[model samples]
Target: MRVTWRDHSPHSEAFDDIYFNPLHGKEESLYVFWQGNLLNEKLAGNVQTVFTIAETGFGTGLNFLCTAQSFIGQSKEAQCLHFISVEKYPLALTDLAKSHTCWPEFKSLSDQLIQQYPPSTPGVYTLAFLEGRIKLTLIIGDAASGFSQLSAMVDAWYLDGFAPSKNPEMWSDALFQQMARLSHKGTTFATFTAAGAVRRGLQAVGFEVEKRKGFGQKRERLVGRYLQDNIPEPTVTPWFDLPSQARPEQVVISGAGLAGCTTAWALAQRGIKVTVLDAADKPAQGGSGNPQGALYTKLSVKPTLQSELHLCASHFSLNLLRQLDPEQTFWSECEVVQIATDDAERTRQQALINEAAYPQEIVEDGSKDTLSKLTQQTVTHDGLIMKLAGWVSPADFCRALLNHPCIDYVPDSQLTELTYQDGMWIVQTAAQKTYHTSTVILCQAEATSQFVQTQHLPLKPIRGQVSIIPASVTNQKLNQVICGDGYISPPFRDHYCFGATFELKSTSLEITDSGHDTNLHNLAKVLPDLAADFEKSKHLLTGRVSFRCSTPDYLPIVGPAPDPETTLERFAPLRKDRKWKFSNVSASHLPGLYVNCGHGSKGLVTTPLCGEYLAALICAEPLPMRKPIHDALNPSRFLIKNLIRKQI
Candidate 1:
């Protein structure tokens, strides 16, 4: 049966499954055995967490969209539903939108997906929806290879491919073997094909295959479960012997910057009582206290893994801010303009606008005239404007997270030391006052080096200063956030904030004349009209300086930090040969300990998602990102990479 795909419109497209004989109607193609069983059973009710489902092929994403609609209709308390799908050939974003229109019921869900679909990349791409509850991890690659590399357990599997005959590669014995390798004992699977080869392949590998009444005009379909005999059990590492449950009801978080407050909010949501220990009287007195900051997605034309993560994080952060109260929290809808001064940047932007289907209405090209009108400044160049991007008060946002009912704001208390005794982490202040808790999160910015456990971790402290200028009536209330060599936010509360000078050698928190002058010089490039305002506000130009903690590769250090020596020894066999199998080995994990720092300049965009990621890791819930992003942000990535690099 030859299938016909219709590129219905510039924004829509659809393809019929030639092998699937629909007995119902055109809509019957949407029905598959796996989808029916998943929808009928209340699997999430028995589990105390956000359920996750991973798929092999996302040709049209029909299976995922259908599952999302069903999951939403079923449970209200289902904290989150994560659907991760892999596809080698992805359609254009506009084509996806067009194809999605065929399903009226899925319009709302598809609309959201089409709006935030990431740029095409070879590695994993994550998109968050429904306020971070529903997440999609789309890995654009071959199913067999992708599934083998994936690190996730699927509750239900939609084994969708072209057909046993037409797409034999998808259902080959090797592929089924890989699927069996990834399946847990009770893992369930369903497919439309009842072909003898498929059944034998599945049975040969551990699945207890069963025939079911087919959907539409088809007479039969197949569904099955991984049996104990064929399914291999995971080997428990010595480190995993540690308790996996939540330590206690209480935790002590040191530091009150964005990192600390975000961690506090995450813990509070989990019903964990939190006491924030800060040296200063208030939160955001550190690196997070910047008066104005820009929020923009970073993309690379070469399509690297880092770029993919940033794109996902940027969109997730933007959506998260939208869910919060604008007035209480410090945020603005000021658009971000990425000026095209260099050919390299211009080429990158052009590729992004052409291949990636961003929320178009939110990002567009601005002529010099349009730019001047929007920014209220003379512009000599054209640039791409991100309408959804803007600036936010990092300090105010930190305060909001600390305001939760489960949080106890402990000010003027600085952490002096950390020691584990009586199965509790005791955090002592300089005055000898100690606070005890089973779990402790270090979010003290660059001061994290003071902690014994993380002292060996490679983190650098770079000082940065931001100057404030009074908004003059003629200062032109800039309508959008502008950026060139530096950036400036629209006037807020009678003051326009700009000028951020980065000095790696400087460590003092005191503001300096040189730092102020450097900021003023940088600010003149974007808004030369403000040169006079700089002079007027130079005397009134108060500034704050803080240190930003960053890792070598720039990815945040999140998830469990296993004992370094133990991990190095456990996986030492891999150092000898690249053929070592990780199938049976479990990575070691430190008991009741994790880290969520080293966010660098993307603190606002990555921190909230990092909080969610940490919660998921603690709960052993399904991960929001695919294996690559998880591995990228893994706390031990640096250590493991260094070991691998050393062997070479």
Candidate 2:
């Protein structure tokens, strides 16, 4: 999206300002939005909890910055702010930064926003400012669709779209209805446009509209309050609506792998004490035990639930890793080469490069020459290079997360049965150990479904073997993680972690010669010199094997666990008729049971975001992501989809 600059005013090249004036942009925003919405009063009144504000357009982000400045000035130190904005045409970072230069007072804030502004992917992107007290969720899509998928009850709204005459699509009745759906009884809205259509649309949606003196040269603007007789409820699909529970002070999480440790850490941040139970003697003794695993995200050319989640997780986890390993100990920030091994892979790579429009610092296309230079070896095919991707010792990553004082790690305590009675969960382990808590989170991968209550979940166990090949003269030259049919990590210490052959329906951890041979062959296809050296010294080869838990769909399951018997009976109408429609129904969840499992291969990238989301749900805080994302990862998605399709 390009902005044409004329007479020191930024105008959208596409919509031609749509009867909206950008002249005196900052001053106009302060008066029309800040003053019109009465934000000072709202923030002061809602001092104990989060104050949420929403906007129709995020053009240049002037409204957001001005509101942030006002919030910091008027609110107490403990107060939090959440700003949700929707934009169809997101300007490039360079354009946004250039436009923000008009206001010197916002330079510092503008710079930080530009730095964290996400790529032009059509999904929700979250950014934090003011040390996490001020959060912004940017929905890069049309106002109607974005608001439909949003999951927040707003206190104020800055209806900052173009003039109704210029861009009627944004001011349509559908958008107003969505606004009403996302508002409370007392929600207030302010807009520069005083169009009769806008006023009628708001009134139709139960808002009491009023004309106000306009800012600058304009004669009048509009401000209104939602005066609906009843509070608006979440307009989510019946199958996807999840009722949050009253938060518990203590929780017991099963599994001590990446998923478990990350979930524990997130809960600890919210002052929740946790007891982690693992079957193994220590953490990271399963799939997370990989000595060196690549931190690569699974991307798709077309935006899907999995792709969007992966993108969000990739950005978040990379930033988190940098913070945890400031010294880069056990964590390497190196480029990852995802080579195009065949026609399908080449097409996928090209589509990702052309369609994703990722920032150069995140991902970009790498020609054969560039790939050769980055890997210090010859490559025949062009590939996508994740510039921020790297490798980490999973064990180290888990340890860093579990070091929190609020988390208690109980090892070699395999949970055999889960029973809920009298509002408390009893976790019985195989070693005759019993632990009790008001809340329980299952993060034990495939074993998450082992409990009688969760046996209906469709989780698969995949066996994988990784061969450790000693670093040779040529292997030592490798500079980063490389992948084609398989992945090869940069030399960790004395060896390069190469491998992994995936075997389905297998849980055996036995290291077989054929697995090692398969890995050698995979390596040979990409780096013949390194393979030859490994074959020459085959006796020195060693390996580790582990099992990964996966769902039928690759996306992980992260939310409250569903009560099988109750859910099936409640939604049984779909068993006879697939087209059956239900209204205002929520998932039948077992009171305090949650699960975060089935990440499979992208665990390193996806687990951290899942952790944050799970924590928010448990603590009854505003969700970190949008509703569509939550629906995609809901643990009951499989069951609900099957019922909807009449597959049960």
Q: Which ten residues in a row have the lowest lDDT in candidate 2?
A: 229-238
RMSD of each: 5.1, 3.2
The global Cα lDDT (0 to 1) of model 2 is: 0.83
Highest TM-score scorer: 2
Candidate 1 per-residue lDDT, tens place, 176-284, comes to: 8777877777777887778999889989988898888777657988888888644434632222222255535787888888778877776676666989899998888
Q: What is the lDDT of residue 20 in candidate 1?
A: 25
Overall local distance difference test of candidate 1? 0.69
C-alpha TM-score for every candidate: 0.81, 0.90
Q: Model 2: clashing residue pairs?
A: none
TM-score of model number 1: 0.81
